[model samples]
Target: MNNEEAARARVVSTADRLFYAQGVQAVGMDAVRSASGVSLKRIYALYPSKDDLVLAVLRHRTEQWNTGLAKAVAAAGTPRDKMLAVFDFLAEWFREDDFRGCAFINFFGELGGGNSKVAAAVREQKTSFQRHVAGLVRDAGGPGHLAPQLALLAEGAQTTAAITRDPGTAAQARAAAETLIRCAFE
Candidate 1:
């Protein structure tokens, strides 16, 4: 990559790690500069402002996170397996050393009310995820409406796992999904 591209990548990566580890409000641009080792001039030239940086970081994370989920779902053997794979994805994410729950959820909690752009981004991510689950449900011969319920289970599992520091919540969510699937389609 060119110098500018490389610098921008480093800044975004560093910002993502710092913001996720510490809340967006808690981590300042200076901290990002120090952590990223990118000069302050380059940071501002690239991001312009902390809000801009935060938005960029959120967008970057949204893509990476969703891409990972899509891969996990695609790898499953069947539609039902695909549906359950959502929880499997969550369990793996929760087990990550730096996992801080869903980045969209955490971002919303931090700045959604105050920032319309951030709120919209978070909403888009959630809507997209729900639709993904709904598609899997449809493929599995289940009612599409059950997608929201399944999404809720996955969200709850993530939140619970985050708060309780328990990756096993994914299993609980998978069990719940199994029950829901059985009752809905079987």
Candidate 2:
């Protein structure tokens, strides 16, 4: 990558890590510069503001979430299994050492009220996720309206897993999901 691109990537990665580990409000630009090894001047030139950097980090997190979920769904055999694969993805994610709830939810809690741009970004990301779940439910022979149920389960699982620090939370959600899917299919 070009120098600016590489620097920008480093800054975003550093910022994302810090923002996830600490709250976004807690991590300053100086910390990001120190962690990323990018100059403060360069970071400012690239991101313009902390809010801009946060937006980039949200985009990065969303892309990572989409890619991982897609991989899990693709590996599953049936549409129903594919629908269930979302929990499988969540299970793996919850098991990660640094798993810290949903990025959108965390970001929303941190800045959604004061920052209109961040709020909108969080909403759009969540809406996209719901749309994804809705498609999966429809494909799995569930009612179109049942999508929210599945999405809510997944969303709740993320929060519970983060709060409880338990990987099995995903499995519990999965079991609940199976019952819902079975009922929907019937």
Best by lDDT: 2
Q: For residues 1-186, could you state the per-residue lDDT of candidate 1 as single tens digits?
A: 999989988999999999899999999899999999999998999989888998899889988978999899989999899999998999888898877788788989999999999999899888988889999999998987689999999999988988998888898999999999889986
lDDT of 2 by residue, 59-175 (tens): 999999999999999999999999899999999999999999998999999899999999999999889999999999878778986789999999999999999999999999999
Off by over 4 Å in 2: none
Report the lDDT of model 2 for residue 59.
93
Ten residues in sequence with the least summed lDDT for candidate 2: 137-146
Winning model by TM-score: 2
Candidate 2, clashing residue pairs?
Answer: none
Q: Provide the overall lDDT of each model, using Cα atoms, as 2-decimal numbers.
A: 0.90, 0.93
Clashes of each: 0, 0
All candidates: TM-score: 0.97, 0.98
